[model samples]
Target: MIEPSYYLSNIVQELKPSGIRKFFDLAAGMEGVISLGVGEPDFVTPWNVREACILSLEQGYTSYTANAGLIELRKEISHYLKNLTNIEYNPHNQVLVTVGGSQALDISLRAIVNPGDEVIVIEPSFVSYASLVTLAGGIPVPVQTTGDMEFKLQPEELEKAITEKTKAIILCSPNNPTGTCLNKKELEMIAEIIEKYDLLVISDEIYAELTYDEAYTSFVSIKGMEERTILVSGFSKGFAMTGWRLGYIAANPEFLNAMLKIHQYSMMCAPTMAQYAAIEAMKNGKEDVIHMKKSYRQRRNLFVGALNDIGLTCHVPGGAFYAFPSIQKTNLTSEEFAEQLLMEEKVAVVPGNVFGKSGEGFVRCSYASSLEQLQEAVRRMQRFVESRT
Candidate 1:
């Protein structure tokens, strides 16, 4: 028989699996674990949305959607964004429905990147940004943000990271791991740099609806940015539809067409049933979105407060449903803290370094869990912190 590794792709062989998986698996094995690890909303998909899916199936609507996704779904997305965030797209030409925000990220990277191109990624970012960039044969240049800055990316840093090899910058506002948001003023400055450097902006707004402090701003809403920004968003986070595997991208049709070519060959279309559900979500689910976010805001306050009270020195995240607390006071590496907390206290969270090395001294505690669970997680974590002391 051929050697097992003989036909494996070299890049795939060396790629490390997501850091969240190992800790999650460890948490799963323990009977009483309260896991704050996996980064997804804990809410159930609303009943109305499910009913829409069942209704569509009953009507015999199950079939392959157009390669770009159902036109109706795309139109809903376009309308949703325009009305809420002051951004507009021509649904027919400018939007492409994707398997998830993840596939949108992957295919967009693959479509834009040639071998050896560089993509500037803000560190303390979602873990997938770097790996996706690498898989697309682009270099991931991570620019670190710190607690002092509330985890916001600095315009100066973006300017410095850009070079001739730089093709794009992936910005995740309401950033994962950090849960920090970049406000309108900050984005305007960053937009200027993107213009000066003529760089593409891959803006991931998956957690847009969950922002707390500032009104969420789409990068494409910035002047002259519409032509240069690829906006990736989805129903999962906002609508508690993670299992549905639906996402969409709104971009200049030029980029949308290129991304579509990749989507067509790999994943032909997002789920037709999910798309039907998403149409209902986009149309009438605003109340549900508000209700969930209101609950998340309370969780955020409770968890962040408990973390700070227990001496973790967390920065208050402006948006998204996470509290990124510094574990430096205890002099523990993020992995050490997360793993030990799970072992000793059965409260699991993701280590900051899983996001990037800039995350070395912190831990990401998601508030997307129930309040009671979050309170228990906080209590367990407090005990762990004291034990270390």
Candidate 2:
């Protein structure tokens, strides 16, 4: 018999399991563990959105949607993007609904990446970017950002990473893990580099609505980027609709159509009921998102302040629900610090090294839990830190 390993594709066989899931799975079996490892919203899906899904089912709308997605949901997504970025997207050709933002990212990479193409992935970013690039037969060239740089990718660093074989860049803002949101000027500078290099951008803006300090800027909204940016977003973060498994991609028609082809063959369509819910979410979900964002902001202030007070030295994240605190002072690696903290204090966090090499001295803790849970987690973390000191 052939070895099991022989049956697996070389790429899939070599791919590492998600680092975020390692701690999450460990904490799952333990009692009384406060898990900040997963980047999920603690808020329940808004009642109105749920109701919309319920109504759709009750009205017998249970069949598969158009391969691209429900026309109505696509229209809503178009309207939402237009309002947010002042850029018009034709719902008919510019938007393709996906199973989730994850699938959108996957298919976007699949649609564009050719074998041996180099894709620049900014680190420490969401865990999937590099893996997806690899699975798509592309080389993931990591460009690490430093805490001193506030975790924002610098133009010079991006320029240095580019080579003749470089095909695209995957950018997440309000970034995951670090929660750094790039301002317009910062993005424009990067955009300049992209234009000069003539590279495509897979811009993950799932956390756009969660940005606290300033209005979110869409990459496609950047001058000359409309044709080059694959804008990926979903209802999962801001609308607390993760389980709904619905997301969308907006790009130039050429790119959109290419992604739609892959999505149609691979996913068929996003859940029909979820599409209904997303329609309502895009139409009437602003208030719910605003409320959630406000709550997250309060939690961010509390959690980040407590992290700093406990000497973990975290920069206040501008968006997303994570606090990435440097654990260098503990004289332990990120994994060691996180593992010991979980064993000693029942607090779960993802080691930053899993995100990328530059993430080695930090750990990511989600502040999306209740304020009470966050406070207790912080106290436990403080105790753990003191014990180490």
Candidate 3:
């Protein structure tokens, strides 16, 4: 008999399981639990897009697509990105379809990072960034961001975090947990740093389509940035196609080719039917996205106003369907507040500390649920906050 630990990779073992998943698991079986935990969209996958997948299957699209995904899908993505972000790509070599945006991000890190290289991660960010950087054999250097800045990464902070070993920076605009988006001006300032340092930028724009307050800016679209940027997006949030498991990355051919090498060996290709569905989404799903974004905006306003009225002091999220409110006033740690809310009030939200140390004393509440559900959750949370005060 032997211990598996003897042969296991320490990094994988040392990795903390996602706190978001842990909270979701705890609340999953609880009856009457109103979840503001997961950031999944409540919208059904658009009927038209789903129908496209069905038709593709009927037409014998069950076989694997090209390793880079369907040619037409890639071309459509090139057009979609060019029109929206004004960043043009050849499609033939610049687009690589992935299982989800996660794969695009993971493989990009694998492609670019060498052992012991440093990847600057801005927090509180999506959880995967740090772990993936580590998995890719790079050091994850976390830079703190405060809620006072709406959780936007400051250029000065980024500059201070960089060292000679720094190879890249991960930027998630319309950031997760916080739901705040970076504007063009802010991105330009970041671009100046990137250019000055000659660092690569991995811009995760998964929530780009859901921006509520202003025009979304593509980090790669910043002047002189395309050469050094890898843009990752997917059909999940905006298209409500999470189960479809479709995402794509666009970048310079050199980087994309390197990513494709890793993707081809590991994933081969994205699901064939999903590729077809995503093609339809790119071609005709704009109106559906617009409809969903409008719904999210209404829910955002409702939830934020309700939380503020109850003294939660939630940031007015500019994009994404999350409301990050400081729970500091209640004198409860984020985990305690979220856990008590679930136990006593049956409202489940993720503790902000799971996102990063800076996220302590706050909680991330997803507004992706219905207006009715959001209203009910807010009511329960209001009661919880009041008792604490």
| Number of clashing pairs per prediction, in order | 0, 0, 0
lDDT (tens digit, per residue) of candidate 3 on 300-368: 999999999999997899999999999999999998998888999999999999988899988999999
lDDT of 1 at 348: 88
For candidate 1, write residues 285-338 as lDDT tens digits.
999999999999999988898899999998888888888999998888889999
Q: What are the models' TM-scores?
A: 0.98, 0.99, 0.99
Worst 10 residues of 1 by lDDT: 79-88
Model 2 residue 40 CA deviation (Å) reads: 0.7
Cα error, residue 175 of model 2, in Å, equals 0.4
The models' CA-based lDDT, in order, is: 0.91, 0.93, 0.92
Which lDDT value does model 3 have at 124? 90
lDDT of 1: 0.91
> What are the clashing pairs of model 1?
none
**Pairs with steric clashes in candidate 2:** none
